[model samples]
Target: MPKANSALSRRAFLTSSAAGLAAFSSIIAFRANAQAAAGELLMVPAAPNPHGAIERLFLLHGDPLAGPIRKIVTESGNPVPAPTMESGARRVLRLMHFNDMHNHITDMHDKRGDTHRMSQIVRRMQETRAAAAENEVVLLLGGGDDHTGSVFDELLGWEPEEFVADAGYRVNSAAGVDVAVLGNHEFDRGAEMLRLGIEKDARFPLLSANVHSSAHIARDRDYTSAAVAEVKGMRIGFIGLTTQVDTRIGQPDDPDMGVASPVEAVRNVLPALSQVCDVVVILSHCGYGTGQSRSGKAGADRMIGEGDFDIAAAAGPLTDKPVVLIGGHSHTRLNAEGLNPDNVIDGVLMTQAEANGKYLGEITMSLAADQGRTGWFTHVGLHPIKSRDDRVAADDPKFDTFEKEDDYDAAFEEAHVAPLRLALQSKLAEAIGTVTAGDAVSTATVEAERYVGENALLNFMNDALVKRSAGFANGTVDLALFNATAILSGVAQGPLSFGDWYDVMPYADQVHIATMTGAQIHDMLQSNAKRIVRPEEADALDFSGFISRGFLHFSDGLRYRLVLGDAVADARAEDITLHGQPLDSMSERQFRVAFNSYVRLGGFSEAWNGKAIGAGVPGQIQGMDLRGLEYEESGLVYRNEIIAQIRQDGGISADAATLDGRLTVA
Candidate 1:
């Protein structure tokens, strides 16, 4: 893991020589200074390319003459050839696909950084486009999830009123993306923000065949179901398909939007697209799940909607032209080392790069009308942006390397992303409150204790919700409850900043107060036991157990004993109490409970092998009436509520996490 910019001070950074160049390119200056000050990874270029624009630009490559490009073979046992103009082929195309970028604009710090750098991706794509031959054309396609999963999502607020800038999408536009599919996370901010990105930031068209929005944004004008790109007199048609699972989650902004079946959506559009196009490409955000998982295990099915495998099988017979599917959602690394044969579903050529811009998926193929519009997949593989450690480990000199941030991308970063970076950095670094709680809870501790049982940080989060929501509640709120998975990252001890807490809970979930009787409360708690696994058993659990997101943590004043059985069906919640009183004693008494929006709108249910094993919160809780003031308002988001509580309390108390057998798992 990389160190946070703990030693780099903003004041010193502002005074440095690099900072003096702020008027020119603040991002480049900041990157240089930050690297020097914090000892971050310094990218080393192998050697400058002598061929210039004639050769492909790669951050990692083998012997330039013998084998500069990594090779993948077909079932016939022949090495995939490098890009070259084949006289036999009628049309030559280089399709570059990447998915699940999740807004990691700058270089990442963790192992993900070792592979993905947006700057590196941009440079490679630019070079690919520039080097295209007169007869050959290159197209870069995004496979969805172009938003969320970073501090960028936080700094760039979601709603129209809170928007800071379309920093993420603006960078993509500069990258020259031809078309992108709609990902589930795109709806994380709201439909309006999605519309705003397409309207203001996107230079390319966004396609989604299944997603229909009743929002004010025009249908074909703002976003379309399909788009065609005419390259070198070749008509290449693209149809986008989004997973229907998330659209049903009922986001506040996307209330009017609906998601239909991906297979059905693709079927309807193929007929119209095939009429005028030479080839059809399915820009899919549904998933790449079929036959085997990434781990090489059998039946590696995606937990979500119908996967690309199913889509390809259903849509293959509908189109006479060569069909290609570029996918996202599952974040499957289709060609990690090279092209995996499993990706070829039916006759449709398929590819998906792993999430977070770690690797760029490249498929070099040609369409020839010699034998009825056949598509030849010449080459398929990934271009990895290697880290310093990766370069050192390989220790090979024959491969020429490229800097992670070239001048072209650096300029773009400076113009588009630097200001937001600076603003977010300063704001995150400011100490909003102190972590005066029990010996300053470390992030490591939170990670260790989050799944096993009750912990201080968990108590602190739920307590914050309870305390804040109690203020707005007309009567006393009994307690707060949230899923364990809600906490993405842990907070550091001592002086706390918004960044610290932001890392812990980044999702823009609203706080809600639900009216429920004691019986209903017990049912929710009982369902929780089915998902709870001991820390020791966590790693060994099957896919169904891992996918289950129902394990819960209660706020202070509530206690429950989770008893494990031989199987999940036998598991149950017992000895439940609120304010030291057994909950069963007051079964008829109504209780006001505070929780996040995910709980109120229950969709955490999961299935494996077509059967529900995890017990999610029942959609219809008995005697339930969700009535409250300002509970569902946009301003009452969980993060804001916690921030308000922290500010009011000055700091968390040392006893906030004091576990007095509040929650016991056996």
Candidate 2:
């Protein structure tokens, strides 16, 4: 067993040939970097037969070639060759797709015991590559969302460990991504940082057809043109399209001011790109549909629907493209037509994972000499990413001796992650305030919002918000709204600690207060209520879990009743009463909505229509006497009354208690 290297050699080496540059006219590459590890074997999956010489290999082709490696290619993404079922030459293209890995390097937290899971997955990938090496060669592709700089930036008000280095370790340690496009989050570090990050340790061609680097390529034009990867006598034109919505995400690590429209970017490059590669595979960071909703391709899909790129564009798909998409953000459990077909236009296949490193998109593609191909994929066999949980499984023995151990932990400051996150760990480790004795919870729970009972971390955090809100404490605002997007993964009950708070509410959204009209308030609560079931119907909904099983506990003195039924359209004026009375439409009652800053800034939740005054959420640095009052004391301040009201809402109907529970059982 070959040990994986923990750190990637930062110095870049371009393996591309510049000989055909002027002849191609538009093909470009300033630096093509694809470095090797310590003799890590790249193998292909073994053909489950004994008689045939099934080749299994993981190819280490240098950066984008100087010219197309295959005959008959398309630069326009048009003129897609007809499908050739004649599986002659037996070419099997395997791309190891990894996406949305938000810097979970260095098993400090051992998040969710994913270490064990990650090792197993990597080992499997290795074994598969080993088998294929005898015949078919696999392509390792990074789907995007590599650097989580923003998550750490907000957490520490500055850059933590060399995050880009950390991500490289993760990718390299986990068999290294051969060719990857950018995730929207990668921009969190901005251009200079990204350049600095990419300058040192990056060993692979980070391709993004749509995103142009700000720094010049020595010439008067863009530095690196989208790359076309040629694997095994095949001209696989690879273009990367990250979500064009980076400006809105606030990662800001790089200084590149704008994101060109991905659709337009693809359109601009397609003609020439088609001429360069036989098959075009778009590594898109565009998310799946709203059902997966961390980020969706409402934009990317619309771009493809316009029939702009590839024979088809698979936004975020799992299978090899006869053209298919494997998407990440807005992680959705998908395995289907990676395409959106149009009679007047070409089609595209798309798929997305369910988020947070649990699935691996695998596509087994067989290209025919006749020029066409056929493919299908499944979401099965996918497993959790590297585990981060440490208490129970600090050291997975398998990884203990892996050669890359030193490299993986070296990128990030192991000490700071723990010290910086100490406040969250312990609290998250224990069960918060218990449910009424028998309040049931799901087995194998880690996230804050997964459990189906009263959660201490959640309630306490909300309660803290409620207490700190100017309107709630002083009586200027009416009812407030703080959607659960602010919290994820629950803490086990025990001595309340800061680590618990950090883990549960890992994001950095400031508390927001707003005064909404009775109509807005009504819409908001109704949205919250629909999560009882029918998640699709709750498109704009902010809360979901089992309502009766303590889906959420709205702060005390805040309550509304609803008579819900089938279709959301049927939702009429059941009554948007506030504190035992009909909402006084004539009375200008300002509502102080307490929530994370992102919500107020219009994140996944409804836009904050500043009808009421706004106040920043309290945190650690507010200054002494002011500090104590403004400081955030993690967990809900625990007012018994608020809990009682949530309980009184009659959430549990007995049927909705268990997985089989039809409704959130009381």
Query: In candidate 2, what are the lDDT values of residues 1-666, reduced to their tens digit?
Result: 112112212121011112122223232211223231221111111111121111111122221222222222223222223222223333456665656655543234433432422333455566567777322446656667765522333322224353323344233433445666666655543454455455444555565544543541110111132554444344455566666533233222223444556655554444444443445566666554321122231211111112223223422232233454555544455543432232112335455544444556666555444444343322222433544433434367655333333222422334333333353344335433333212332222423233222333344434444544442443433333444434454434323233333444444343334555554555554434432223343343223321111123354344444344454333233444566556646235544444343443333212232211011111111110101112221212222223233334322222222222111222
TM-scores across all candidates? Answer: 0.76, 0.53
Please report the TM-score between candidate 2 and the true structure: 0.53
Q: Which 10 residues in a row give candidate 2 its minimum summed lDDT?
A: 620-629
lDDT of 2: 0.39
Regions more than 4 Å wrong, model 2: 1-92, 102-114, 117-136, 146-175, 184-225, 230-234, 243-268, 287-324, 330-355, 364-459, 469-480, 496-503, 512-554, 565-567, 570-592, 601-666
